[model samples]
Target: MYSYDVKVLPKNTSLWGGVGIEKAISSNSLLICRNDELGVSLKLFTKNQDDGAVPFGTLAPGETYIFRLNEVTLIGAKTTDDVSDSMVRCTIVCPQSN
Candidate 1:
């Protein structure tokens, strides 16, 4: 098991910019949580950025989301507010390597 904090920047109105988690090379599960101290909402995406479409989901402050996958996958995140930065905690769980 491993965990880290990811910083998410504000996105422009015309461009969808976000951060991606690609470190879980062999992980089977992923957990993400928005920082309770932040006031901005966190948006989550699977695989790639949704460009101009709506995000896969949105997490309020102190809220959490989970993803189950059979292989490595990219997780994307950004803030709903266009002027403030936000953060999320990511935890990855992988099977034991023999």
Candidate 2:
């Protein structure tokens, strides 16, 4: 039997009202969608700044989107529904060996 410890890097965060997460993710990091509702719009961009933002599509309630971002630097999200100020919760995970 082989046993190993997996370390989860960084803390989970949430974005609301078209705001960006305070912490930027390094390229090829893992992004896990925790909770999303009210038609949240997701955007991902590179660290180059001038690269602009890339639309990563939207997610609904009880739905999850998980992916290993490609050269992703920052991530921003907001609600696309008729109502004002929506919230989306996401967990950023980077696997590290013990």
Candidate 3:
């Protein structure tokens, strides 16, 4: 496995999973993880929403969220600070084939 950067700037950004690359995120601040699809094991969701939308549960200043997937998946997030260059940097673990 290998690691790379996926940044969530002041605006929004989408992270898509694939067979070649596996994503595992460790953020320096609060980072959101949203999935549009339902019943995916790695997805986070809230009790009030039936659409299976949820946060990655407040990834503190130094926390990592590991995702396990066998198929392609899509998700998005942004930093809470909203600074000019506010970024939520995630290190994506990619397989050798990637």
Candidate 4:
């Protein structure tokens, strides 16, 4: 996962999954995880609309929202979640720094 500066702590709460910003320099499949002071489990929408669409507050075009390393899905060139909802169409980024 890309190292993005964050301001919020990982609180134990349900996640409302959504797609990624397509016009971003970097894009990846984003998964919302839930941890209620117990083990961690990813939260997904019951319907198909939320399957990949990023939340409304995520990486909006021209707007950058800081996010934590929720998780990484693909690795090779750079590193990203392999998200399909991203607006930009580019190759996958594999993690190389660490």
Candidate 5:
């Protein structure tokens, strides 16, 4: 298990201004949630942060989402407001290998 406080900054002209998490192990699932006390909406990207495609999903403050981690190579996060930075909390859990 691992926990991360991902910082998401405002998007700029050249970059999306976010953080990415690459798969490190054969994880069975992922638990992602926005900080309940503060911050704005968060947009999630399945591909690289620089990808031109739209975000796969969005999570509002105090919201939580769960899914398989193996299907994603990278997970990117960015603030939707584009004015302030957001701190998103992510928790990853992997089953022990046999």
Candidate 6:
């Protein structure tokens, strides 16, 4: 009943690609899956493509981070910024399947 998340359909979102319906999820905490912080998979893109990169090992309060969709695939990453009702959303701009 709080927040929500959804599987980005078609797997890619470009200017002319496609889009997935924004689902609601209650959990917003991000996951860092490596030793180096910047080498993370989950990412939040702001203006100028600034990385809302998730920190490794720990989830900081008021900070943004992300969870990888898998080992190789970084697209359709799970975002933690969508945790609260007031926090901003982190959407992944994937390539088109076709």
lDDT of 3 by residue, 1-98 (tens): 33344555444445444223344333322223332221112212221112333465444333445554332243444444555322334444443333
What does candidate 5's lDDT look like per residue over 4-88, in tens digits? 7777776521122223433333547665555545877777765443344346677777787765555454556667875877777
In model 5, which residue pairs have backbone atoms overlapping below 3 Å?
A: none
CA-lDDT, candidates in order? 0.57, 0.43, 0.38, 0.24, 0.59, 0.28
Per-residue lDDT tens digits for candidate 2, residues 1-98, read 11222111122222311234334444545666543354344332223234555566655554766656454445545444434343444565666768
**Residue 86 CA displacement from its true place in model 3, Å:** 5.5
Task: Identify the runs in model 5 with alpha carbons over 4 angstroms from their true place.
Answer: 12-27, 48-54, 96-98
Among all windows of 10 consecutive residues in model 3, the one with the lowest summed lDDT is: 39-48
Q: How many clashes does each candidate structure show, in the order listed?
A: 0, 0, 0, 17, 0, 7
Stretches of candidate 2 above 4 Å error? 1-28, 37-50, 96-98
Residue 45 accuracy (lDDT) in model 2:
26
Q: Work out how many backbone clashes candidate 5 has.
A: 0
What lDDT tens digits, residue by residue, belong to model 1 across residues 1-98?
Answer: 76777777775221112334333344455454545565577676655332333357877777877666433345566688777876667676655568
How well does candidate 6 match the true structure in TM-score terms? 0.20
Error of 2 at 74 (Å): 1.3
Report the lDDT of model 5 for residue 39.
Answer: 78
Give me the runs in candidate 6 sitting further than 4 Å from their true place: 1-56, 72-98
Which residue pairs does candidate 2 place in steric collision? none
Q: Which 10 consecutive residues of model 4 have the lowest summed lDDT?
A: 72-81
User: Which TM-score value belongs to model 4?
Assistant: 0.18
lDDT of 4 at 51: 37
Clash list (residue pairs), candidate 3: none
Report the number of backbone clashes for model 3. Answer: 0
Ranking by TM-score: 5, 1, 2, 3, 6, 4
